[model samples]
Target chain A: MKKLQLIASMMLGLAAAGSVSADAGKDTYTKVCAVCHAGGIAAAPRYGNAADWGPRIAKGVPTLYQSALKGTPKGMPAKGGNLTLPDASVKAAVDYMVAAAGGAKAAAEPKADAKKEAKAEPKKEAKPEPKKEAAKEAAKEEAPKAAAAPAPAAVAAAPLVQEGASAADVNSFNRLLKPAGKRNLPPPEDGIHDPANDGTHALQPPLAAFGSLPKSFAGNRVNWVEAIGSGKIKPRWDRTDLTAEPIVMDMNVVREVKGSMPDVVYPHKQHTQWLDCSNCHPAIFTPQKGANQISMASILLGEKCGVCHGKVAFPVSECRLCHSKKKDLVKPATAAAR
Target chain B: MRKLLTGLRGGLFVGLVLALAAVLFVDIQDAQAEYGDVVINNHSDAATMRPVIFPHWFHRVRFACKVCHADLGFKFKAGGNDINMVKIIDGQFCGACHNGEVAWSVENCNLCHSAKPGTPTQVHESTIQKLAQPSGASQKK
Candidate 1:
């Protein structure tokens, strides 16, 4: 009886913890949605602003779900950019946002409407209401379903599997680079981001054409060059008149970690080359100096520089790239000799 | 009692050695790669024989990395950019901005043609003064 009670209590605890974490949309909103919605970047509707979300909510929950899932014409990317989120979690976030702005009535009914529409839309796996009946396997189904959702506003999310894709291939790159037959990359279209015409580069990954690529950037660069040379992948940078003037932040501040190592020169100009100011500012790193308690340990665990460096950009193994010496550090005699 | 004391002393000695080794290891394995001088000698020393010694700290204090790296397409690796006299003469690579408009022209080759001898090279006093002076945000065409 004691064992039974203990097990029952543990189950209750797990359920309560999951509900508390998942139900509070505020956490999701801050992490994923705030990147775009906090400042209404790229015309994303601001959070809790009724004027912004009400019209979007009025479109009904299914339409909102479809728009949120498939992506909207008005610059809202499918799944709000962090494609790691499960459909249920995303739905919960949307519901939270609606409740905050459009009131409780707006939150409750659209879910019913979404269920009504999902039942009518397709006869694939027939698991329409991921919220109610299928809550048992929800955790298991989270990853693959997210991956199967694929291509921001580009492709219709067909039911790739009864459950989600493998938990291993959670990131988009894995799915994109999944070994298939030779994939043909489409020509770079120019209509979505042409402020005049709304041309953008948000295209479906050439999944059919893509075979497994070398994981490393150096490896990929070699493959890319080989593909271009052999007429496999089309040239992107060459033969284009589009020249972007690189923005210089001129915020070159050297942070000295008082340790055995030399001071770290945080090159504002270097990082801002590929990323926007907001990408790192107040998110990965606070704009204020010494605010971020960065260490080699956290970086290795994929928090700071590890987020991109090891994954996509150059790895941290090339340490000399950032921990540069100051101009005054080297003696004139040493400088002249070198 | 003698055996126990000997064992304790030996253990203490081993612990001290380990601690010393750890300190030295920390010093040797400095995660931050001390930024220093870069010697660019692609064709400068090989074919034409005039190595281009790049002043890194000078350029960094003034402009961002992307200006030369991304916009100008200058590679980080020394001699990796495949820069040649022809590329610069045609107002392409180095000539794009250094066409006597944004900076000195390619005609003045000796300015960069000088080789390094391992002594730390200093930036021009005028360059430092210009950097110290606040400049407008207008981008060069």
Candidate 2:
């Protein structure tokens, strides 16, 4: 008897946790949806405004679902750019939103009408003209059913699998997720964002450019990159130059100079964007290095670094760029010769 | 008929001799030359010849190969460029860099292999300057 009571209480707790709408949803609405919907930009219905929602709610839950899912001229982003939320969750959010706007009567009226329609459907088989009405209602019910199930399954599977996979694999998986091999829409296309739903929009990865460079300048600095990663780079109030943090990158060029030897943790990316790919590929480094003989002797003879650095790109004349730690190795004669 | 056979045999012999000369000429012309002042008998061989001689001054100005070679394709190894010379000529091996827009026109031979010493090489300084400049919202382009 005690075990049965414990099981009943656990089930109740789980149900409460599932249904208890978070203030995160409200916060998300303020941040993302409030942008257009609050001001009625592109005729988007206002967030807390009842007049805009009353007519929409009267059209019933499925119509509102269609407007949110398929999108409307209201300029509301598909799923409010929160692709992480399940379709059912979005519907619940819609329900919460509409109820908040004094449209509870319109929201509650749908189930009563659905019950009435359900009762009247059986009666329609006895009557001739009513069959058309029953069929149309049945089709309406089927549409939401078709749109709901697959989306939740897809949303649930996409994030966890991607959390660990390489960026290339995630891109390939995204392609596979598309229907019929058609171009898939990005997160914003579905009027949904995952972070908007769970107060964790902080975690959704931005669609960065190749090589993890931010596609936009909004997050230009390395500190901003950490900010986008999840304010986890530092405590909420702390500030530090993350790029200036000491980086000891050990790279080994395969058999060119020394196979499997540590390459100085040269501040590479800092200097890379400074030059072109041709600077290295098939050049200082061979298309294949072990195939060619690139020796330190060559670099010293004004051929590699000696060729231009005394003149350009902060010259190898400044040895500290490469040998930032081993300052003693920088010979004064070498600097004088340059 | 005897005279005709003699002429035919002579013509065949001439063709064989010419073919042999042509092969020798190609082998010498396609041989790898010493790079910089570095000498490496251990690394040098006939097979490694014509693999490619990548020019540094021409490339450093335009791109960082780390983006392409390390980020895009895996690092290369020896004997990797067992490629058709014609394909490379048409835009494959060194052709990747030799593409006219990025660096020297592949059509010019001595541009890459100029034997002259102490000739100051030109690097496109503006390209480096442009890359170093922090790109704003325009980073997408």
Candidate 3:
């Protein structure tokens, strides 16, 4: 049975593609159907000519659908070569044709009334009051500007360095600043100094990284230079150009790491403004060198400093950035003692 | 000796011609770079610089890379070599971003087409006035 159906469909498909049934209703009818059907052109049947279509009307709806699906014995091309038309369209055209052929029973069935009955039968009335209540609740929920107010508070609390702070203060400054302008590139306009003006709560920059701002300087923040490169600190992403040409940092060391020559100061805030702290903190130093088992051997072998310095940032080839002093003179008297 | 002299003269003539060509080519290239995408000459005139420098870094911070590149569909490279002021004012390439919300609206011609580089503020005010004006002299006709 399935095989027979398949054969029948295939036959219909072939007939549809061909140019038979030119005058008989189906086939590629829409493009040309209106011309003749709207008016009896060249003795063609008028669209609503039930008297003329009475004989064809005796045939069933499915048969007419098939006829439209597969062209008649005339020169009409099957399916109109308008592959976009679905079987449903063909069925509607068949219905129209059948209705034209005096199949008034199918046409006058009052489909709209039936559809209305099917959709309208539930007659819902009980739950509307609850929905209205829900709407009112939603409006009430939306009334307060509470959510919007917190953003300014959040911005105020974000890590931004107040002026005249230590290296620690600089770190908190960056953290606070990071959240304030999540999407934009920093240092933000108004120059990362003023607090955001949304009125959620009183705002202040994050607390300083060091214990307290030195008494010598009451309110001045150290320049970005002192924060990162000072005290033997080495910054990260030195090679990565954030906005323009690579910056060759000049740092003055304030402290020395043990067993390590004086810590070549790394510029913290300047580099932080360019890149995030995660770019260096763990992989590069791990808060402190010995905490992560970092060694000069690993560094020289392209592990840490070797990653950028020799290749992109500035080659360790200019040795002074790290080893600050020249070799001591070997005096002749000292040589004799040796 | 005659052949050598002839060769030297031929080489000198070729060298001089090539040298002149190279100089002209370099100047032309430099001029192209100087005027690269300057559609608005008014701003250029008011500012000390002939072309108002629309540096990428200056704008990229506020707008996302994708906002101009993807949403507006600007090509990654600069100096399309064919971008025109009329097309911009009518809201084709750069106008998509420069439309009032993002940058200065390009509807006013002198805002960008100004050839003077004097006071940028004065030029900006004049451009705003021009934008506010009703289509005037031509309307009388």
Candidate 4:
């Protein structure tokens, strides 16, 4: 069966090289569909796996095309997550996969005939493009109903996409700070937790629990540092050891800048509170003073202090936050005078 | 007339300085991910999903770096490992912990694939290039 599938794919590839439509199907499959379909991730039907594709094929070819184009709630992203792909390309890829699975000889036969016709008469090749464009239009009309049908009940109830807002409208960066209304949803309603999991539904909603914790302006709106300091939340220091405690160090490393900007004061107390010594040791920073050549550019690019500041910790927008210490002007001038 | 030309030039210099300052201020505002955030786009963009934003800080706080880099065979370099959904669901890379037993399973797609669409796979604000070269070599450049 595996050998047969390999021979089928090779034949498909050769046929794809002969014609534009077949070529697109194979190309789209290789580029987009293969990522999950090739491996059957999250129950996605594996290419050429008869058992996996059997039940799905029973649902019919049009249904399979819909699943491939619109995506399934099971995990498949619509158009294999590339919205830029034309509907015809997506349908061709779906046909390619269906053919490879050996479920639809009827669907595969026309493609083979098309390949032969393309070879015999190159002019006829232009004919398919119009048909494909027409298919694209038909798919566009069917898209809304197919998209609306399979939306999981939980997704519809919670509605991660705000009302009247398209998917593109949502900002993807710096997810730490959510809008006030979106902040602290229940575990299942929150996009992070799996609604299908019963355990997720049982967990406490963040809004209800975070009410007593220390408040901050950014990220989930809870000041983790202050919360830890005030003993509001005690995050485990180790994954396995229940009794393990963090070895907190209350030290500060002050790095002087060359320009007029104030010197940066790195507080070990805050960092050590959450991380172990090895996390940022020789790999990220050398222990000795003035040993590490720190710069604003490196940090901005996501190095050194940047590894965390703009990501999970407070962002670099608070310049005065890190660059807290004022430089001693008289001492430098006096040393220069000498 | 000669004095007027010098005054005009002086005014232009001040305007340029102010403009430069404004640009620098805007640049700072656009700083990338919070520290230790790795954006894995190895396939997501082409697959039509947002790039995966792996929160290094969130993971490190729970388990040491050795747990992943040392035990799990993850290289220190960003995008160094060929992580795919198949390998992850099959219990490799992120799957080792992200499996329902250790953490949340792979069902929550948007949670990790949370980056803005078109975000490339990379270590957010990667200093790896700078660290790879000697301090003197970078300074000379």
Candidate 5:
């Protein structure tokens, strides 16, 4: 199967190499980036949002060029996941996105040549310095003006940024001072049904491995819920939609085990966020409970949920990811002791 | 004040039980070092119905890791390679040895593309001979 794709890619590469044109970039952006950037999908910087694009655009077209040409650590795939595109076309699309989000100045910017882009590493680190220093100076100057401005850094950040820097660039620079602005918003909603914002009655210890997986392993469950709950990271999918437009399906399955293990509770709503209903329905798991024979052995062998868990998605090694609740087991030892 | 005290007592009890549960379960968590075999599915559904299962154990017998990885630039991570059929046919990546001269031509589709399909119901079988006897490829200097 890989061989066939290899051949097909070869053909596509040949075709793409021949038809490489400047206009292809706009077409590429429409096809690839529009989904994410247009609606702020997956926290992608919305186009024309100077605040979001400010810091990124400040990195110069070359650095942004490389991220789009290669890939971001946050799972934005190279060439927007269309691997067959020529490198020129990928860079072209990057410029197109930068311009759309960053405004006219980014569009007029010259193309980033490879050697110059590669050598531009020093500039990337230094780009944010002026903004940071300016912000500090603003704070020092403003100490006498008023008791305290809510976000003096953000307020004074306009003069720090170059005139042409887009809103995104300013937003990126101001994002640094955002921690100081945390208190500005109204207190988070509090209720037993809703997760608590403050650590008032926090139960779990500091989740060390909440941000990223330490190492890849089978059965390693990357608990999205725990990760989101701990406030270390947010789910890429639209989590807020769950509140207003809820889609709930409570699937409880009790498997016959030799000893004691909690029954599997498959919540349909969580999976629906990232995947379509058809991805798993009649094809992967039968609709009828007690119909399919699911076991740990089959999962390890790459059947059922194993299809996504360890491969493209997180691993299943973390047992608690599934058996979220504790169960009362009938123990013969306790009865015998009595 | 009494209500507040009751709530505090409940919270403490829950926290203690959860902490104890964490300690008991920490030992049982999977700390095994070795990784399972990788199932390459990039192009499985592209041509034939099945994906290729490349067993590292099978290749570890034949060649030094450096030969295919360092020299040839085969990425150690799975799904890292840009391996398309044209490059392979031109003697790159798997094609380095998979050419008929070195091993077998890729003409026989069933030769290596033999793993279970992503579809749930598809039954699969592996013909890649697992040598019960010691492998001869390991002796290659």
Candidate 6:
């Protein structure tokens, strides 16, 4: 009876130890590594693919750990771009992946105590199967639902799972519409700059300079137009020639829409303030009225006016902002008939 | 006979108004992308990765079109340029700036491959269906 009790206690201790490391590895992988590894992105070894793991495993476990720790030139960011993760946790995640790919023997050297634990709980290896299936299902179902919903404008708005790894949707692509907390981080802290570089740490934070700028509701919450007009910011018009002046065309092109929405009055004055005429002419737009087939669909797809509006400028969400010109309701019937 | 024509006109007006409302609602729902962002799927789908969403405006504001279009050898058409990892790490195309010197290196995969899963390589699907519909409001012109 005493021997049985001692053996039972030992089994429980081993199981707990094994589960702790396994859970930690899974958590880290799900939050960080899964973004690329799960999909084999950029040729990242897919999770649970023994065939993919065979060649990599032959290279030895230390090499795998080194690759994960330092990152590869083929596009694996060091520590999977989550620099906060401890080295031990990353190594454990690697072990977890290696064990799953039928390379359990290779991963046994580093964690000898967990060897028996891992073999005892072989069922734990199969658990990721269900999760992978669910992720694939979710990916599959999301496509059709996104298509059925109108407007592809929000298509690119899909959350980048890497940045925060939280519930809050981080729009990493658009610098203008970052979440409130993420806005105006210091140069080094901001993902744009290399944190290791001393120059980045010395640079002025954007929030400090942006304080005096005129405020707007959208896109970094600064009214750039108002700032430029008020002479608060004078952007150099040319790169090489200091005296080069922008040919600011004040022309407004009004596009007539058939629906109840107001006609789109595209102001060249605002556009020409920043861009050269050659930027749009001949390439994006033909520079003739009725010659260009400017549709809302094409524009939403990142064409014509969309080349600027939904990207660097204000997003398309502000409807009244663009569809400003009121239709002449009194003179409509004659034009419609013709 | 006169009343029937008047009634027909009234019915048509109501239908047009409803159609217009539907179209506007769709536009509002769909228009969610930051302007000047291009989604590049060219090979990502086959590679089992999310499509790359290139923020054109972010670069455009800092540099002129000629810098990339002429100097860097990037083609004018979307998805026209054959951008691969080999060329990038070898110091060509995006790698010229993204090589841990000018900007962030190509280490961060999700930074570029952050598009919604299954997004086609095209900038946006041309609304060929909407354009084909003869009864749509645009046809009135």
Top DockQ model = 4
What is the fnat score of candidate 4?
0.06
Q: State the displacement of the C-alpha of residue A36, model 3, in Å, after optimal TM-score superposition.
A: 96
Off by over 4 Å in 4: A1-211, A329-338, B1-39, B44-81, B85-92, B104-141
Instruction: Return the TM-score for each candidate structure.
Output: 0.25, 0.28, 0.19, 0.41, 0.30, 0.38
Question: What does candidate 2's lDDT look like per residue over A242-316, in tens digits?
Answer: 232222233433231233333433344443333344545555655553455544455444355544332233433
Task: Count clashing residue pairs in model 1.
Answer: 30
* Residues A199-263 of candidate 3: C-alpha lDDT, one tens digit per residue: 10121222212223221111112222343334322323212223433234344323344543545
Query: What's the distance in Å from true for residue A336, model 2?
Result: 57
How should the candidates be ordered by TM-score, best one leading?
Answer: 4, 6, 5, 2, 1, 3
> Model 2, residue A231: what's the lDDT?
27
Q: For residue B24, give model 4's deviation from the true position in Å.
A: 31
Candidate 4 C-alpha lDDT tens digits along A77-195: 76776655777788778767776788666433443343233222221121222223435532332222122222232122222212212232255233333333333444443333334
What CAPRI class is candidate 4?
A: incorrect
Residues B52-128 of candidate 5 have per-residue lDDT tens digits of 44533234323333356544666534555867779989989888778886566788554455443441111111101
DockQ of all models, two decimals each? 0.01, 0.01, 0.01, 0.04, 0.02, 0.03
What are the runs in model 5 whose C-alpha is more than 4 Å off? A1-21, A73-77, A101-316, A321-325, A329-338, B1-141
lDDT of 5 by residue, A115-205 (tens): 2332222223222223223222222212211111112222232232323222222443321121111111111111110122222122221
Candidate 6 CAPRI grade: incorrect
What is candidate 4's CA lDDT for residue B104? 85
Question: Per-model C-alpha lDDT, please?
Answer: 0.44, 0.36, 0.34, 0.57, 0.43, 0.55
Q: Write the per-residue lDDT of candidate 6 for residues A207-271, one digit (tens) a residue.
A: 45567888766654556677666876665564334466667889998989888999989888877
TM-score of 3: 0.19
Docking class of 1: incorrect
How well is each residue in B4-119 modelled by candidate 4, as lDDT tens digits? 43553354334334433443333233333333456676787789877676756456435645456545777655677999999999999989878888788999777776665554
Cα lDDT for residue A174, candidate 4? 34
